[model samples]
Target: MDGTPAAEIVSEVAPRAGETIVTHQRVTGFHASSLDVLLRGAGIDTVIIAGVATNLSVEGTARAASDLGYRTIVVSDGCSAGSEAAHSASLESLGLLAEIATADELLTAVHTPATV
Candidate 1:
């Protein structure tokens, strides 16, 4: 989630179990303190991103993840946008700059490990 409202919604629908949910105040980047702390603490090397506003929060986080030297994967099908053009453009951009895959592909990669 990008902000408190979205985070609240996610919490209402499915409370975060052991995973940490970091809320960024703006879309400038993914330099959130909570996120950095969580990722480092959890020893997370790869970030599989999926969420609404594909061109906004999702892209921001993916790009930041890349900058942070983490293996970033954008789940194309698991994300959406207000318009098809925006969504498609976001996917294309991420594919060109980072790893792009569907949710199933990510699952398989995680499960098999060698397939990645």
Candidate 2:
């Protein structure tokens, strides 16, 4: 699995030098990974998640992150499911636990300066 194409991060989103990468083996990224530890170590309280399987891995991770007390956000357009209904349903359910935003909204929020 380590050497397989499926396990590789695509070039577009590949990690740059000095960036930390954590690998997970369960449906939720935090289940058996260093993600929680790494985030806590970095003093991160917010988590933005984007990936495939809107009804499975994405939802699972979002729920786990929310339950862990992190402010979670799911990029709606950045995730996909086997069908539109499934994706919509997942997002609807996740809305109760996490914030849902489109890629554009996320980018704008990231770029907008915070005012004190």
Candidate 3:
């Protein structure tokens, strides 16, 4: 995503079809044009986020997603942090703002819908 060239950070996770990769220009927000357009055009109602730098990118996008009225879910285990303290802090904050769940929990919830 970074114009500097797709670094190992991204190369390590090769995207499959039907997935769009948008690079963030900065840490303050989702300032990338491609990201905004793709998200909006795709009609993404919810964002199940999982990535590195838990206290940075993950947190930033999570906040932005919540503000955009998306049902955001942070996968606690799927994300990593520079430190355990930072990781825990990010999870706590996300729990206050969005639905924080484990990978297995999310998978189960997605596969099974609740009855009215």
State which candidate has the highest lDDT.
2
- Score residue 11 of candidate 2 by CA lDDT: 98
User: What are the lDDT scores of the predictions, listed in order?
Assistant: 0.80, 0.96, 0.81
User: Which pairs, if any, clash in model 2?
Assistant: none
TM values, all candidates: 0.79, 0.96, 0.82
1-116, model 2: which lDDT tens digit per residue? 88898888999999999999988888999998999999999999999999999999999999999999999999999999999999999999999999999999999989999999
lDDT of 3 by residue, 3-85 (tens): 45645456567888777666666752465546656777888788888987899988988888888787889999999899999
Candidate 1 accuracy as lDDT: 0.80
Candidate achieving the largest TM-score: 2
Q: Give the Å error, residue 37, model 2.
A: 0.5
Tell me how far candidate 1 lies from the true structure as C-alpha RMSD in angstroms. Answer: 3.2
Candidate 1 clashes between residue pairs 3 or more apart in a chain or in different chains: none
